[model samples]
Target: MQLIKIDKTQNYIINTGTIAGDMEGTSGGPTNPGPLSIYLEEGRIAAITGTKDDPYRFKQPNRQTTFLDLGSLTILPPLADCHVHLALDGLDFATARRRWEQPGELHTQISTQLWDTVRHGILAVRDGGDRPGIALRYRELVASGELTGPVIRASGWALRKPRKYGSFLGRGVPAEMLDSALGQLARHGVDQIKVLVSGVVSFKEYSRVGPVQYTYEELSAIVQGARNLGLGVMAHASSDEAVALAVKAGVNTVEHGYFLSRDTLKLMAEKQVAWIPTVVPVAAQLTSLHPAPNQDNYVIAKTVDRQLAMINEARNLGVTLGVGTDSGASGVRHGYSYRQELALYRQAGLTPEEIIRCATINSARVLGLNWGRIAPGNPAAMIAVSGDPLGDINNLRNIEYVFQPV
Candidate 1:
């Protein structure tokens, strides 16, 4: 206990043993599910159990103890966001672009965004990319304890081929400069690599999309280059052809797979590449742009339905999936967006447990971190809601408070 730097005079215990969420064992496997008590030792969970009526009364040599009764709250793992752009304020394209030009303002906005995200119970975030190394800087700030926020996994700057709409919040690295660009991110110590293979869907032209940025071979080279530097690749792909091409190149995950076909999804499953549907961006945008069932809203709604069906199909076919709200996209607010994403997944046929698992466990897996789940010996990064989130997914919004990096 002294080595862990926990207060030796008092043993801290959190009890009343309300509930145990998804992961539940020391071996990193599931255990019996029920109300459980967790003891805090050295800022980590020393003991966790559901059977005992008096959980805080544990034997400890030469130690005084204090207990925190959880009462009726639900105990669950910390949530993770698989994709985001801290640089964008999630308002509109023009506002987003203007913010980039004002560096001082941009940094302040990032601080606000990070604070809001973590305060909302998101413990870890994978920033897809942002300019001027803001994402990496924020990650450093979090690591150094200068800022109290989530563990940031940054891609530095997303890569793309030279073309229009290619460098929205990322850099477009030419084919010849692929190795050098990857080296730069590696030098900055990025957690992963993001490369754009296609553009965002155009609201004005409902049937079309942003132009394809990289061919299959080009994307493959970027993947290989990043892998050489010990980084996995995630691609921003939305069209059918672009999604197929990205999967063929062996990117680790595909973002916003809006128009993916069954065959392409099967291919992704075969290759073990996960998909982040990012359904809330569209939902948020559609509601913001045109509340009624206007032509644009109708078209986007239809597309959203198709994408949700494909995601449902992906689950049935055993394709791995991670959830993200694409927070910071147009009209997709950060703190509240993830709840919307979870609701959309539930509407698309995922159970509340499954949706919560995607936001916590599966998202962590995609980010390649050991930060989720409530297991003894694991860090006590957890959240307590006002009610059982498993019973009603909407209760996730009722997060009373969160404790993380425990």
Candidate 2:
């Protein structure tokens, strides 16, 4: 990896973990005290000390490299998008496959998506799942430096009960055949396991709660199976029972818990399971893609409002929430929906620092990565924004640039 240094004279390094009144302070900004020294070596932070000018003044290990000055730029650890679909944004699986039928076409699409994510300052992404080969192929390309994108940790394909939610892209086999399916996915080198427990309301079919995809027994089996193989499980559950089952089954993350109850939220907090509300898909479906007709918009709007209410309750109860844009649904677009998620989180009553932490440190922890902080030995995945996001959360949408380890 090539070494690069960004120097700023007047910029303040606000610590998000501190309990300061305002985000900015007197060290340089209006609220928080700033760090005095920050050093990077081999893509990891070598040192970070309190306000002491020239903390590394005595150390003279290497002076052969040059430093790149980024005047007046505030640097922070790279952001993480906890929930996203690399293969299925707006367009369906059939369309994506047709567009990438020829060799290198799929590679190009992956490259564009990855670069777009980096441009938006997202350094790590947890791709829920896609068709078998797509995610694995892209992961290989990214690792080989053949692509410019965030560090990807992907589930090869989701596993759902036959004829259930996302069955097309998931391995919807019988319970008797699940072991074989998991074995196949492991051979394909998946980073995690994705299980679909309930149907999404955004999809026209089964929108109004009817049949859940997996039983508690089935979920437990799959969870145990994945754990035995040393893989984590991410579940797509929207209803109360489904979320409960997923939690009971020992799933690590729950996606789109729209109808989660207060008890369920408490259980999640107790179990330390991370939640990704994915409010964008539900909101976009009602407003942009499938708008309500006639005078019934009010009723439909209330349903969306109810989902947000559940999220708010979860937050108040101390559930670990992460950033997720259920991108690639019929109407949602990838790379842009994340901003909507941030806005929704704020609307659900989270402070600016809380919201940023959800997208950065919290999301990274959910994905089991050690690269979210700017401390020593972490990956040099960092983003620089024009304004302090602690004061205004919307500044996240206006990311200036992103740098990922080469």
Candidate 3:
């Protein structure tokens, strides 16, 4: 498996086994019969037309067109990671933070993580905030072609209440200084605003999440402030109380919503706010490569099960659900943990097609990218896998080629 960067704008006609979704990119819909032809012009899909029996029957190629045939591989929209922390390495938090002070070392570390992310067929990612603003710098590096990585939507640094739990994410701001804080972030060129509405989920105590960080009025003011700056807010909310408050306060997306109630999910649906339930970071506690000596696996397992149930319920309530591996957390690794996260989605009873939709289109929507669906006029960001992901989601692991738009 290798990642191929399609940076140059040239005519390309790629023939593959099948397309995973219909022309509109809806999951579980009729897949185009293969061997199908996908025509790309100027980095956008010009057309996709073919027949199974006669692969090249309707083919018309120009002199400058490049032709490639993938006999038994399936073509689908590339994956996207809705939540991640590029500054942390997931192995040793202290060590990663120390390296942040060394610009050369930090650059090397993040560059490797980006390559790993692309190797896993993920072409875009929305980075959670870090106090040092390292991820934001990397976003600009990638955009300028100085670094080859996913298209990044980076929250420069999270905003948390004074003495809250997000010290590592950003500097704390008092309620009275909310507008000034947002102005600072906007001046730093943040793609979105991240707010820590709550602390975190507990591992020792089942269903025990950290306390809510902001009052409803305070959170509402923060959301409005970000909106006024022409930015969306990504709230780091865990407990049901915090989740409810954030949703009502008009936060754009909820991250790490561990113990959300069904009612809150319904409200999120009504409000059209997407949820990125970062279950992998929590579930990874039970299956860490280096398990803690006194860790309580039972409580962690139960917590994961409950989160999965809510995920299923969220899907049922028509709430937009995005696939997010809180990569770079304690037990989650960049690129590798993505498959684990999707597998957990399957445990939540999401069908393979549904899971694919979440990882592709839904996550793409969260990242504000237009490259998830493989339709005419869509940016040609897709991956070719050896087996049909619609039949079995694990087949996505066998990524043979990635079509990334520079």
Compare the candidates by lDDT and give the number of the best one: 3
* Per-residue accuracy of model 3 over 253-340 as CA lDDT, tens digit each: 9998988899999999999999999998988888787776666899889989999999999989999989889898998889999999
Model 2 lDDT tens row, 81-108 = 8777777646454676575566567656
In candidate 1, stretches whose alpha carbon ends up further than 4 angstroms from where it belongs are 1-11, 23-35, 51-66, 101-103, 205-207, 289-295
Q: TM-score of each candidate?
A: 0.90, 0.86, 0.95
The TM-score that candidate 1 achieves is: 0.90
Residue 45 lDDT, candidate 3, scale 0-100: 81
109: Cα error in model 3, Å: 0.9
| 1 or 3, greater by lDDT | 3
Residue 119 of model 3 has an lDDT of 91
Candidate 1 Cα lDDT to native: 0.77
List candidate 3 stretches off by more than 4 Å: 23-30, 51-63, 292-294
| Candidate 1 root-mean-square deviation in Å | 4.0
Alpha-carbon runs more than 4 Å astray in model 2: 1-32, 35-37, 49-51, 57-60, 91-94, 100-104, 202-207, 287-300
Model 2 poorest 10 in a row by lDDT: 14-23
